[model samples]
Target: MSYLELEGLHLAYGNAPAVENLNLQAGEGELISLLGPSGCGKTTTMRAIAGLLAPRAGHIRLAGQDITQLPANRRDIGLVFQSYALFPHLTAFENVAFGLRLRRVPDASLRERVNEALRVVGLTEFAQRLPANMSGGQQQRVALARAFVIQPRLLLLDEPLSNLDAKLRVEMRSELRRLQRELGVTMLYVTHDQEEALALSDRIIVMRAGKIEQQGTPEDVYARPRTPFVADFMGWDNLLPAAQAPAAARARAPQATHFAWRPDAVNVGLGEHTGQVLARNYLGEYQEYLLGTPFGHIKAYAPVGAQWPEGHSVSFDLPAERAAPLMET
Candidate 1:
């Protein structure tokens, strides 16, 4: 059995259901992400797992033990939220040692554990500093340390890095992934950022309308979307009709009724297909183009130096091998 399992899980707020018939599993030491937009039940599911929200139906199991009805404090799970939630009056050392103190750990052992937790997050030097004295990233590190100090069975992070700047968010992604691997802890991360999910997770569960739309590796979900919702949400810019689909994609998916292509798959210049550039944006490393094509306005990207301005006529193509066949729902 997988180390963490949610079977037939149903969550609700009063009469309105937030999640229904949801089932997922994670292997030991694996880091999985619950990915979706706001109100998609990703946060609700995380709450249920952390015992903060009770499930209306189904079961939750961890390490072969049923924790479905357990109260939050008894679940032995660590939770990190978008907000650092650190106590302003407490020093970094005290905050990280709070849980251990609650467990009535020996003074010597508590000190050892808290110091190690800080060291793991590279925050040992800030141990005596109050959260008010630290930067956002440093405060977040302290929160992580606090969660890990207790050595919980599983870690639940709900957009924990969202508060940081874009650059720091990327840095924290690497930090969190490295920490998870080094600690060999099971983690369930919740996030709306597609890049963050793709970068940090060993597996991803894409949720929509309070249910699992698709669950798979990042590559599988991105390249071989099984449903229209997933194909569209996973960044397929051009979803063409059957007749317009490239022939190669059709051969790979004989029964497919449509085709989808990522923005990068459409070559922006010199091709059998042509389109007028309706709009464009210069991203840091590449350029994005909104092209008015027969396929109903395709989005395409070119390397940084490609400078086709808006209103420019450019040739492009939906390469046969680059398009993915989409099956009918």
Candidate 2:
């Protein structure tokens, strides 16, 4: 049996169902991400597991024990919300030691554990600082340290880095992954960001309207998306109308309707197939090229310095094997 299992879990707010018949399982120490757009029940699922909301139906089990009937306080799960949710009056050390204090742990042991957690998140130097005194990234690290200090059986993160700026989000992502690896704690992360999910998860569950559309490893989900929704949601923006795609791609893909490719998957260069460069936006390491192809307005990327003048003609090819087949039927 899996260490954590949600079998046919359902939750509703009064008459309307927020989540329906959801099922998932995670092995011990596995990092799983629930990824989907807004209102897709990613957060709803996490709330159920955390005991914040009681599911109207189905079961939630942890470590082979039935936790479905347990209250939130008894579940032994750690949660970090999108907002830092730090106590405004407490110093970093007190905030991290809050959970330990609740259990009436000895002062000496609480201090030791709190300091250890701070060190793990590289926040020991900021122990005396309050949330207002720290940078966004530092505050987030303090929140993470607080969650870990409890040493819960499972960890739940609901867009924990969303509060940070883009640059700090990237930095915190690395730190979060490093801490998760060192602890080997079972985790369920909820996010709408595909790139973040892909970068951090051991497995991904793509949800839509409270149901799982697909679940797989990063490579499996990206390289072999099973539906048009999956393809578009994963940010595979280059959608090729069937008639204009390579003959082989059209034939092998189901229903012969549509094909999709990642911008990086299509090569923009001199080749037999021609494209008109409608626009080019230069990024630091690379450039995004908007090209009008026979398939439609397809987006292709070229490395920096590989520029084509506006309205200039360029050749490109979407390789047959790498072209992701779309289930448009």
Candidate 3:
């Protein structure tokens, strides 16, 4: 059996369904991300797995034991919130040692474990400092240490880095990945950021309207989305109905209802199709162009040196080989 399993899971808030008939299996030490927009049930699923929210139906099994009805404290699960839920008055040491204290672990043993957890998160020097004195990144490490110190069976992180600035978030992604790998802990990470999911997950589960739209490795989901919703989320900016696409593009997937490709796939300055550049923006590494074409408005990227002003005509192609065939829009 998988290390963690959710079978026929149903979650709701009163009359409103949050997740319906959801099923998932996660292997030991695997870092799986539940990715979607707000209200897509990713956070709700995390809450259910953490035993904070009761499932309207279905079972949750962890490490061969049924935990669907277990109390939150009794279930060996640790949760880190986006807010970094630390007590302002408590020092980092106390915050990380809180769970051990609650369990009545002896003073000597709890001290060793708490110190180790803080050291693992690279916050050993800040142990005597209160949360208010620490930087955002340091406070976040305190929360992680608190969760890790418990040595739980599973860890649930709900947008843990969302509160950080872009640079810190990127840094934490590496830190989080390193911790998960070194500890070999199974984790269910919840996030609305597609890039974060792509960067960190062993597998990505895209959720929509309380159900899974798609689930696969980051490469598979990004390169070959099965539906328009997923294609759009995965950064496929140029989507066209199969009938509206060029003959060559449509020929690549005769049965597809639609086709999608990223801006990078729209090769500019060397194709049979022509379009007027409606607008252009320098995007650091490449120039993005909005082109008004016969088919529709298309977004494409070209090399930084390839500058085409607004109103200029440029030739581009939606190469058939680069298109992702979609069965549904």
Candidate 4:
């Protein structure tokens, strides 16, 4: 059985159902991300898992033990909120030790465990620093150390890295992955950032309006999205309305009755049709093109050197196999 399971979970605030018939499974030590936009129920689902909100129906299990009725204190789950939730008055070490102290662990053992947890997060050197003295990324690390100090059976992280700048967010991704692997704790992460989800999760649960839109490995979700929403959400930019693409386009595309192709997937200067480049953005690694095509404004991406100026004509071909079909429903 999965280590953490939420089966047929449903939740409603007053008369409005926020989540319905929701089911999820996380294997022991596996990291799964609940990914979606704001108001998509990802945060609500995380709250339910953390025992902040009781499900209107369904059960939650951890390591084969039913925790559906377990109160937040007894659930033995540690949650790291997006806000870090670190006490400004407490030093980093004190913050990490707060939970152990609350549980009245022996002084010697608590000190040892707290040191070990801080070390795992690479924050041992900053143990004496207050939240006000540390950078956003460092505080996030402290929050993580605090959560893991309890050695909870399950860990819930709600957009734990969203507060950091882009450069720091990238740097912390590797750090988070490393610590999670070292600890071997099951984690349920919730985030709206698609790139972060792809980089950090073993599997991703794509939710929409309180329901699971699709669930799979990063490659599966990116390369073979099961729905239009999934494809669009994952950054597939060349969306074609079902009735707009050429009849030949439909016959050639394989994944959906209606489909989209990634910009980089189209072969420029080698295909059956030619389009005029209406605009271009020169990213360092690649160039993005907006082409005026019969199908509308088609987007294409190519290597940095493989770009043409606006008003230049470019020939591009969509291989039948490269286009993805959208889910009919």
Scored by lDDT, the top model is 3
User: TM-score for each prediction?
Assistant: 0.94, 0.92, 0.98, 0.95
For candidate 3, list the clashing residue pairs, or say none.
none
Backbone clashes under 3 angstroms, per model = 0, 0, 0, 3
Per-residue lDDT of candidate 2, residues 218-309 (tens digit) = 88887888777889998789877677778877767657467888988888995568999999999787999999888788788899889798
Residue 101 of model 2, lDDT score:
99
Best by TM-score: 3
Any idea what lDDT model 1 has? 0.91
**lDDT per residue, candidate 3, 196-285, as tens digits?**
999999999999899999999999898989998899999999999888988887877899999998999999998999999999999999
Off by over 4 Å in 4: 246-249, 252-255
Clashing pairs in 4: 255-325, 256-325, 256-326
> For residue 173, what is the lDDT in candidate 4?
89
- Whole-model Cα lDDT per candidate? 0.91, 0.90, 0.94, 0.89
Ordering by TM-score = 3, 4, 1, 2
lDDT of each residue in 1-329, candidate 1, tens digit only: 89999999999999999999999999999999998888999999999999989899999999999999888999999999999999999999999999999999999999999988999999878999999999999999999999988999999999999999999999999999999998999999999998999999999999999989889999989888877778888899688867766666677777878888899998988788789999998888899999998778899889988888889899988887887777656
lDDT for 160 (candidate 4): 90
